[model samples]
Target: MEPMGLRERKKLATRRTLQHEALRLAIEHGSENVTVDDIAAAANVSTRTFFNYFSSKEEAIIGDGPPRPTADATAVFVANGPTGDLLDDLKHFILSPMLDLSAEELGYTFTDFLARKQLMLRESHLVTRMMATFAATEREVVAGVAARLGEEPEAIRPQIVAALGMTALRFALRHLHHHGDTAEGAGAEGARAAEIAELRDLLDEAFDALRQTFDTAR
Candidate 1:
């Protein structure tokens, strides 16, 4: 990726400060007791500034939700491209956001992911907020699936396919949460390729199993 501009870097730094402070305060105290003002105070920013970066205290603690599919990626899928098969296309479409930076540039390291997983597990009360974010992401997936099929977003086909893709993703994520250290020791996208490839491999296995299950029933 190109170097971030000064404004972008400052914005990113501010967001990271809020995230780091929010996580620290929540872990030190209790998430239920940690209000937005408290987080803002801890970060040395006004509540308005805090709200500028995150919608709520919980949002800062959980970090950003899943990235959206790029317009180009969605258009390609709608045009039946990158590959023609539906299952294959869907997998790539969903994973594309994570893989956009290329293998050497994939920045989301497994160690970071594992740490986030542990935080979520440790603070189970925040699951509801996380789920709400996930629901929004699922809706995006459904919209893309529906568009590709020339159907309404409410169509069952879109919902089912979206759920299946999410299932494989969750499977891959759960595996990574536990075994991250085994694959990549963290830092740099170059070292993180194995971690992401593992995610792709697990997704492949999951979809393959589903395909076999359905084929045998037929």
Candidate 2:
């Protein structure tokens, strides 16, 4: 990776600040209620500058999130580290960058929103939109990974693996969000590391059980 100059670093910091403010405002006021002007004011950036960073208010709240990588970036990230095993590669590909989120970031974005949505599932539209975006982006990521590995992108197993991994991730996120803490509770996403671990373990166990059932049928 090329070293970022001071100017570039400053730009990124400003962008992050803007996104954070946008998210905070959206959580407080609802996504539709938080306007670009509001985010720009909160971040101390002009509305024009806010437009330079994000195309829409929703983008500001989502803030180039981990699950939605651009095609080129996803290709590069997938190709950089190639493990021979497909499952391990899938897990690494999906989970690595996610590990970078600060505890506060997770709390603000996910953990705090879990319970109300769990009971009401009122954010189904938001969830659907995010999942669709994630699926489309992740398909590109897997295609790049498959190309690098000399596997056909249309091959059944690879497609199935990608789909299953995505499902597990969404499930984990919803589980953590709904059950970890209500929007009013403390500890937020910071204290849910253990829960995350357990969710991952459950995914593995579920996969193992499916494998055994297939073996028995075969």
Candidate 3:
């Protein structure tokens, strides 16, 4: 692949700077107390520049908005016929975001931001607000998955699949966060690859266990 152009590199640097500074300020001061101007000043960029990247201070602190399947993943979902394995397809759909990410490209995974958010949850109401937002995001995921499956969003099967997929994702992320330091000795790329592999393994195990439980019950 071609290297990022100079302008693109600069924009990425600025965005990373903004995210780092926003998290730092939110941790130091309460998330409620931190303003767009505060984050911009901390990042040494104008507030206008911050707006260019993130619409809200909470978004800056959270690293980005809620995770969604990428367009490529969505296309794959749409193209998949009715005979495909729903669980496996959903797993790949959820995993698509982290797939093909080089270490340099993997700036601040959700686990990192979530760990920091836990620390700040004590003093700020942002965590509560974010949870509400996440619920809505989950609904959106349910709708997307339902559409791909040619079912209603509220259909029992689609809802169950979406909920299980999201739960597995969260479980994988938390597991990685707990075990992340095991990869600290590796090089950056190696560490990221290892983490992704570990997450996939954990997700597979979770899904397999769920399948077994249902099969045994039947």
Which candidate should be chosen as best, given lDDT against the real structure? Answer: 1
On lDDT, who's better, 1 or 3? 1
Clashes by residue pair, model 2: 114-177, 114-178
Over 4 Å off in model 3, which ranges?
Answer: 1-13, 81-83, 136-140, 178-185
**What would the per-residue lDDT of candidate 3 be over residues 129-206, giving only the tens digit for each residue?**
556655665676687688887899989977888888888876776566433434677666666777678878988988
Flag regions of model 2 displaced more than 4 Å. Answer: 1-8, 67-83, 100-120, 123-125, 154-156, 177-199
Residues 1-218 of candidate 2 have per-residue lDDT tens digits of 35569999789778878877876776777777889999999999899999988898876665544444334445654565445555555655666544545555544445433432442253454565445556675676568566656678888766776777676666555555223444336465634464456556655655565567767999
Q: Per model, how many backbone clashes are there?
A: 0, 2, 0
- Candidate 1, residues 1-218, lDDT tens digits: the string is 35679999788768877877787777778788799999999888899999898887888987765666777788888887778989999998888777765433243334344556767888887777766666787888889999889999998999999989887877777786334333455545435566567778888998898889988999
C-alpha lDDT score of every prediction, in listed order = 0.76, 0.62, 0.73
Question: Candidate 2: TM-score?
Answer: 0.67
- TM-scores, in order shown? 0.81, 0.67, 0.79
Cα RMSDs of all predictions?
3.4, 5.2, 3.5
Pairwise TM-score winner, candidates 2 and 3: 3
Off by over 4 Å in 1: 1-9, 33-38, 41-44, 101-112, 177-187
